[model samples]
Target: MDTLCSRMLLFLGLAPFMTLAATPPPTHQFTLDNGLQVLIREDHRAPLVTSHLWFKVGSADEAPGQTGLSHVLEHMLYKGSGKTCADEASRILESIGAEENAFTTQDVTGYHQTLAPRYLGVVFELMADLMSTARLHADDLAREIAVIREERILRTDDNVDAAALEHFTALAHFANSYRTPTIGWMHDLQRVDAGELRHWYESRYAPGNAVLVIVGDVTLAQVQPLAERYFGVLQKRPVPRLLRPVELQLPGERHLTLHRDVATPQLLMAFNLPGLATAKDPHTVHALRLLNALLGGADSARLPKKLELTERVLNHVETRYDERTRGDSLLLLSAELTDPPQADLDEVQARIWQEIEALRSTPPSLDELERARTRLIAQQVYARDSIAKQARELATFQTIGLPWRLLDEDARALAKVTPQDIREAASTWLTRERLSVVHVQKGGGR
Candidate 1:
């Protein structure tokens, strides 16, 4: 979320968006005549509002050779629309003293602006204008392609850690477009023309396929009129919801080792697990949450204790899992090697598997499991302290095909997870046969 990453924030692949909290967010929902759905929450805390537009299309929807079109389209929408000169959108928002940004995920693409409550109309009109009339000029598309291509190179080609993660994720999945990068393949991006972008936009950026989320010091009555006036008349059509694929279980463990010129070695392990909204068993979702917090969600977790302080083999480690993904969830454990000679890469790798084995064989103590549960709950409660976070979480859930009730539902489910439940999650979901390991080792090259 820095100067550069903020604009290109979608490329960062942040740990995960939104925390599972106990208290459900307050939201008012309505659909326009043209099928555009709108959700608004009145927060009189300050005279400010956050306006968001989420489209139900992302990387997974892309066909081969057309990857990254969604993200490229996101950039062009910001470039400008009818009667709005190039970059004029930003100038107008800046004049109003507002903040605007956007990002693309595996399941959705979103654009947002935070400004005064009085400026709500301005934001709405601009968003509608872009959605309806963005001019995908050939010159503009050419410029943006070059910019996005540079971004792909900086984030992927020269960056070993990111490259490893991308490859590992694709290999872990049996088959699908999810293996392709959201920023897109360099070859495909070079060939993506204005016509291709316009076709995707016209087909996917319809009112029926979008959701409007507004959070601020405004009532539903006051906002409804504005939404309908600005967004109502758009043509209605059925959204082409992607029929998700069922990921086949990997027959045996999949491992990949990268030998390249690098400063330090890196290790990544991912286990495909149940997603919260898509899981058949509710308990599996909750149990996996607790297990994640216990393992790599915190500083005092197992990876730090076993690999860094106790065995003293590694120094950096982080775990990530998104149970709410549109597709299968991946529980990932990643670590960077320490400098001072401790243990060779082989020994470190063996210890990593041993940690998972221990969790399956022996369930965590009541105290350990309880601590993780309590910590997770606390984090969710604190997440509400930020109005922006709550609104984004609400939009994220709704856009990804999950009901808003999931906020409280997941929290309650986590409370029922016992030590045995955690052990079951490890044994059932964290299978050795499905595990995928990738290592980036040092080699003599650029």
Candidate 2:
């Protein structure tokens, strides 16, 4: 994740005077009678268009026993639809020289296609068909469940680092639905039947609960009618009330340790924080975003600079935070031990606390602050170079109940994030009550 930021920082430092595009291609928005939202941006840079169909529901919307139902439904969509056989949609896309894929996250699930302008309507037709009349056969459900279980095994169960993160996240939140992994737990996958899947599809996969974003060499005139002819015709239905449980306040830091079969030792520290949509003070959100970059989002950040490079206390370190989420988010720091440890998690953690205390006590230098901001700006500028990223950014804002214009406000808001603001944010949010720590080492059971 830091690779792109590192490269951008290097380029910016060496170039001395490099400029990105001043303005992005104009974006247009409209809503259908059936309540489906559509946003289109015309980028004639290439004869290709990227379309993303996004549903606002994800793992966070699922009930306790029905964890991963949203992700499983995403899989079943590719299995078959009213007009296409199992995997036929993928085959059709391949035949048309198009690239297509789908993903499920904590707050959104999206299916996307990048194809020649001539194939725009065909892709929309496929997505609309899947939305309205996906064939959730019993046999397909059983098979896909097995596939999902295998996927969990590979992504979470077999990987020690990922498993540690999973356990940490679960312990971080008690009532918040985010405690559950997006791929879901192994036991939850075993009991999901076709009926439950069909119910989830019918309830959550409605036009009212979705957003369609198209970017590239396509005009609103060309895309709008295609959207109407396919997606507009689908009947809108009531979606389940998104009951995102608030995490009750905890007294102090929550800690856990897991011993797994791994050579490298791992450490994770997370501070529960409000995301963009949930924050009462938007400035704090932007400040935290900048603080993340200063701490670990970049190679030149404090964590890697002080610990990994200078002190040799750790070999790697990075921070993870997502402000686009619908509910609370985590400011996470993950690190691994050096080859022959002169320091353990206790020593590394103490050093980390010292750095945090430094930030809380004193503001960063103006030059250091500017570098972090520039890196974030470069990331946004690079993201706009891809149509898929542009579409996703638009859809994500819409899904999270924010206007796309908020993206335009980002640079201005981020620029206003003074050093004092960063220090204040760190002091206010990174508290012991909001913290969770996980330690992983080589061995058997905890």
Candidate 3:
């Protein structure tokens, strides 16, 4: 079970970074009187418009006992507001030939709508209404809890990869809020009644904690009046400043083994690394991303080519550097063992380490670095093809207190990384002392 879980983590860790090559629309940004930040990106290529509302709060902001408050609040936002009833917002949206949805992640919660440009005001009104006046009625809370429970079951319980990643994170950040699942522990959810949810909503869901992002066929001058009329008049509430506790730096490697019903062996490894916020650190995060690409990101990456293609000891492999929401991030490497014997597993692990050591000792050839950079750049260009992606990118940055301009900055940074930088990053951050390994195996020992 441990081995299988680790392999699953690897698969997820290496999922493609979507890219879009087409030129993005011209964007304008501003702040409302009540401290709500707004960004407008004008694109006349299509008559449709995308509206996104990003809240600064998410899973990491939740209080200790209220594990999934941000996620639960995301669902409840659509339940009812000042003038809308449970699910009525969806009905109205569909009636106007629009699509709308919301999602919550570790760092932010977002609500979005895409519709013909004419419906922009309607979209804004609906979003503003919900943001200021969501009603967490008892019956609605009760019904949605069941829905979310099922969602949790489907995502974390039924799916092996998801379960393993969740467990891996839990163990990886033992002292941090990131350790908890965003969907929350089932037990925690049971205790989150309507009153508790309402308290959470009142405290965190305020204009000061939000940002509005729009893309498609709208200019700053055109949308500013409507935005002011709809969103500006809301009374400001005193939102408490976020104070994230610092985590003690991990000094050495940590290992854990988990058992579950599974078909093959898996290994999950994570190493602590500095986050993107600290500029003086030489952008190890980006270099680690490049390292992940060279090691196991693509079909022809080192792990796949060596383990699956040549050695035939592993069926698949994956590696990634998670750009964290808060505090330090992680560089993860995961793999599946073809045969589950202890000796073989140990040997496979050694080979993985050997590959890392080689990369650390010797800079990648110009060709290898260029190829990985090209692939990464191509993926970024592809992800920008849709207005949805543009909106998501902006929301993600704003949610994490980063300037949306960082998107371009990151592209430039990725371009500037040298092969020597990759080697240095690997040696410094990917050291064995900073590593944690999780192995998933079958229930009974061999």
TM-score, ranked from best to worst: 2, 1, 3
**How well does each candidate superpose onto the true structure, as a TM-score?**
0.92, 0.94, 0.90
Q: How far out, in Å, is residue 183 in model 3? A: 0.3
Q: Candidate 1: what lDDT?
A: 0.80
Report the Cα lDDT for residue 246, model 3.
39
Please give, for residues 57-171, the per-residue lDDT of candidate 1 as tens digits: 8888888899899999998986778859888988999999998899997788998989998898998888898998999999999999999999998998888777777888787
lDDT of each: 0.80, 0.86, 0.78
Q: Which ten-residue region of model 1 has the weakest summed lDDT?
A: 10-19
The CA-based lDDT of model 2 is what?
Answer: 0.86
Scored by Cα lDDT, where does model 3 land?
A: 0.78
Residue-pair clash count for candidate 3: 23
| Preferred candidate (TM-score higher): 2 or 3 | 2
Q: Superposing every Cα of model 2 onto the true structure, what RMSD results?
A: 4.2
Tens digits of per-residue lDDT, candidate 2, 225-260, equal: 898998888897886665544565653689998998
- Lowest summed lDDT across 10 adjacent residues in model 3 is found at 13-22
- Sorted by lDDT (best first), the order is 2, 1, 3
Cα deviation of 93 in candidate 2 (Å)? 1.1
Each prediction's total of clashing residue pairs, residues at least 3 apart in sequence or on different chains, is 0, 0, 23
**Pairs clashing within candidate 2:** none
